[model samples]
Target: MEMVRVVFLTVFMFFVLVTVHEWGHYYFAKRAGILVREFAIGFGPKLFSYKRGETQFTLRLLPFGGYARMAGEDPEMIEIGPGQTIAVRLGQDNKIKNIYLDSLDTRRNVIRGEAEFTDLENELKIRLNVDGEITTYDVNPQAMMIRGSQQTQIAPKDRQFGSKTVGQRAIAILAGPVMNFILAFVLFALHLQMAGIPVENPSYVKIGEVSEGMPAQEAGLKKGDIVVAVDGQTIGGDYKKMITLTSAAKGKEMNWTLKRGEETLSVTMIPRSMEGETGGKVGITPELPTRKAGVGETITKSSKAMVDTTDLIFVGFKQLINKFNMNDISGPVGTFQLTGQIAQQGIQYLTYWAAILSLYLGIFNLLPIPALDGSRLVFLGIEALRGKPVDPAREGMVHFVGFALLFLVMIAVTYNDILRLISG
Candidate 1:
């Protein structure tokens, strides 16, 4: 039962992360006036689906990943040939009715330059270009449907993803990772508030070790003894404060209050006040204390946590590249195992893990690898600079290769995780 519970928790966390990431893309795409065809929470066969506006939101079988399908996001075919003119028609069949190219009438039924024909929300238009003279004819719905045909292809001017400006496309692509960062910040802030954020030091200092024959050891102080107060002054977990008070009170009888576990005891001893290379010698090392944070402090801590986590991710990436540490990488199996362990630690630790994982997802997705948001932004950047979009087919091929390599890397990482699990 415990194992089942762990599995459930792991799956639930994965679902939440993937759904939120996809929702980010959907939200931005909609805001950019692009038509979102589908917003799916997972891959594989659909378990359930519902249509909202023009988008079909679905929950699929696999919980590994999700996607937001925007219209015209996929590659569309375009044909260029030496001809007098070509008639491009938008209909249920996508078949050109006639070809007036080279002034010779020819009837060939072929789907030319297919576009996404999922829905017919726009008018049906047929393009006629004769000797560089271009004209568009808006065919009547009834006339186009005379032979059991309907408008299946969308024009470039329609509210499709490819029709959007480069800036808009970049925003839509970049929004997914941005949402993950925001989610991480919110989670971290909540965890800090509930768990009482850890401060530098709290209200007492612990004696780590005492040198024999020294004042602290001779006065009966020992390791693990927490100094609560010295000479009526509360140390309040400040080890430095206790040292300063001891230094000033050299040669005077000092009163010490120590907390040994649940019990407190008092001890008195006189300092030697000897001058040495190591300043005033208390002959005892202290351990730091943890201070609990309040509301404002928690917020500040959470913000710092976000910034620190981001910096750590970049540093880790640098190390991975420079040191080539494959062991440092974790795949789905390792992540699931870690998630289960965190779940057992309690809600606060689990929340903290969630925040870290969210930040990781956000940063990792921004890597300029193909099939990723960062890669899309890179392409858009090139398009912006070049004053036009790259060929769709070439771009699609590049993403396909990158995705294949990434998939293989994931397989290797999962294998390593399994081997490590079995060996350990």
Candidate 2:
């Protein structure tokens, strides 16, 4: 039964993250006046789908990732072959637009002779007809396009993304990440505020759980023990501080002050290392000892926690960068492993974690980094500065290269995930 619950939790968390992540892109794109073609959750074949307002939404077979499709993605004509004109589809047949290319060579390949179909493909993949479903068209096919087939393709036009003012294009590109950042902050704040957010209070440090047969058990410190102090240093009358002192003193015996049933007594407890990990182990736990509080207290505690947690997240990101290694980034498989651990933690814990993660994911996406919302925003910044939009060919080329690099990084992280699983 526990195993079943774990599986359920893992699946739930995966979906929650994917849903919130994609929704960020979908909502912002619409608000920016971009024509969305699809908003999808997951990858691979579609399992369920529906369409609304010229956008398709789909639930795919692989519950790993999702996307948002948009229109006006191309600005220049694409020459598919030598002396051969390709009829590219920018939209429906009646709404279709076409342009002729100067030559057949890729604008991206101009300096190096390579071609990119990303500007068109990414937009198509994001534009599934409101059913969250997306279709990836093969750009390598060297055949004439049939009528109505161009909706899955991009064409050259002033109405295309290349023609838009830099400010407009910048907003459209940056909006998704901005939405993500906002979602994360709001969700985190609200979640912590709910359930009378727990704060580190200097009250009685009541034990909630205990490790079996550990040094703490030998010392006779049982569950419900209200920790008072350690080594004669007052622990603000809290449980965590008591554990902290003991854990720090691992491999050595320490004096502990605990309140048991209205009786105050000092006992020596040793934190011993436990199997599976290194640390001082005191067989004890922390309890919330919940009480009904007024709205003010609840808000204060919750808001404080949210603010602290938010700061901590950014700190963690910086720390991760400083501690940069192949081990840091987590791809789909890495995320799956996290889900497994969350599974072990149980549903309620995972639910709380999920909400918190949702916000963090949103923020990370919004950072103007390459192949990320932040990076897209950088382009916007450039456009806003130059007063003219970056050349479409050049902009598309940058995104294509960035995306390729991003894919490589993902593969590396996924490889790390596989290694951890094998070693673990």
Candidate 3:
């Protein structure tokens, strides 16, 4: 059962992250007038699928991760505006066409003075002639967005991506990660601000329940004994977080300060042990902090939750790195199998983890690692600085190597998980 919980946590985390990451890319790519070919959840063989617009959406066999297949993202298709439209020859050989558009509207083609195509297809190679200047557009059109599937048909002026301008493209790519970050922030803040939940008043620990034959019972602690202090340490604000300070002193002798009915007393006891990678016991049950919230209190608690969530993601990443160094990662077989067991905890535990995983998803994707949105942003930044694009071949090679390295890392983590499972 314990092993199951571990797997459950891993798989649950994986799905949440993958979905958010891909959604980031999908959202922006579409917005930018870049054609998206496919959006897939998971990897390996395709499990199920549906088609919407020009994209064939897929649910892959592996539940570990997902991808957004955007048009023009293919290094091989570097020649393509990333949108497809047939270019109408503007002049007899020598003169090209001129098109104009505002800087902000994200588009692949059909700008000011450009001859727009009548229709678009999933794959289109077009070159717009503007006076003497010839411009290229590699249109990756969605079927629905195109005028029709019929080869003879042409879309209206608005349907083709080749009609858009450069500024539109930038906005499209920028939208995905921006949305992901916003999503993380909103979900996290909402979870923090969940209203009217009773909180354990920092003034005292009102004993809610005592388990049969537990350490509290053996220590002569009874129901309604308000604990003023544990191990001579003051417990204040964020009971869930405070429990950790107490739990950390597990097995060491500790003193407690208590109050009941205008009476105060001191007692000494040791905390009990529970299941964890780190063994910490918790005795007291807590309600939410004060349900009544002053504006200041509400702001303080929300700030704490954001900070707490941030801390947890960093800690989890650190832990994963440590475990990887020690060869301690779990694979798919372990994850979903564990998910089945974690389901026993019902929705509350799942909800808690979902929120936690969402935060991680936002943070991890923002890391400036090659092949990720952050890394691409870095490349764009370089382009802006240089006033020209980076060497496409070099960027491609870097991403290739980065992808390979990450795959190896995943394998290592999976090996560790399996080994740990067997050893346990």
TM-scores for all predictions: 0.64, 0.63, 0.57
Ranking by TM-score: 1, 2, 3
In candidate 1 the C-alpha lDDT for residue 109 amounts to 46
Q: Model 2 Cα displacement at 399 (Å)?
A: 1.0
User: How many pairs of residues collide in model 1?
Assistant: 6
Q: On lDDT, who's better, 1 or 3?
A: 1
What lDDT score goes with residue 143 in model 1?
A: 25
Local error of candidate 3 at residue 305 (angstroms): 2.7
Per-residue lDDT, model 2, residue 145, is 26
Give lDDT tens digits, candidate 3, residues 1-424: 8656666665655666666777776776677556666789988998898877666789898676678775545532212132333233223333223222223133354332243332233334345555646665543322122222312112223333333343554455455555555555555445445543465455545675666665666666666776666766676444554477667867876777777678888866677687553645546565333365566655566566657888977887788767744443445555544555555555444444555555655666667888765676677778778877778788878888888887786787677777777887
Q: What TM-score should be assigned to candidate 2? A: 0.63
Candidate scoring better on lDDT of 2 and 3: 2
Give the range where candidate 3 is weakest over 10 consecutive residues by summed lDDT.
Answer: 143-152
Q: How far is candidate 3 from the true structure (C-alpha RMSD, Å)?
A: 11.5
Instruction: Encode model 2's per-residue lDDT on 1-424: one tens digit a residue.
Output: 8877777778876676776666766665566556566788877798998877657789898665677766565332333433233223333332223322333243232111122232332232111121333333333211222323332334323324445566666666555545544554554445444434455454666777676777777878777777777898887646566667777888888888889998987888767887785668776767765555466765576556556767888998999888987777778787877777876854545655765676576677666556676676777778788876667677778878887887788788888899998999
Q: Model 1 — TM-score against the truth?
A: 0.64
Off by over 4 Å in 2: 44-47, 61-64, 74-171, 190-205, 212-282, 292-307, 317-323
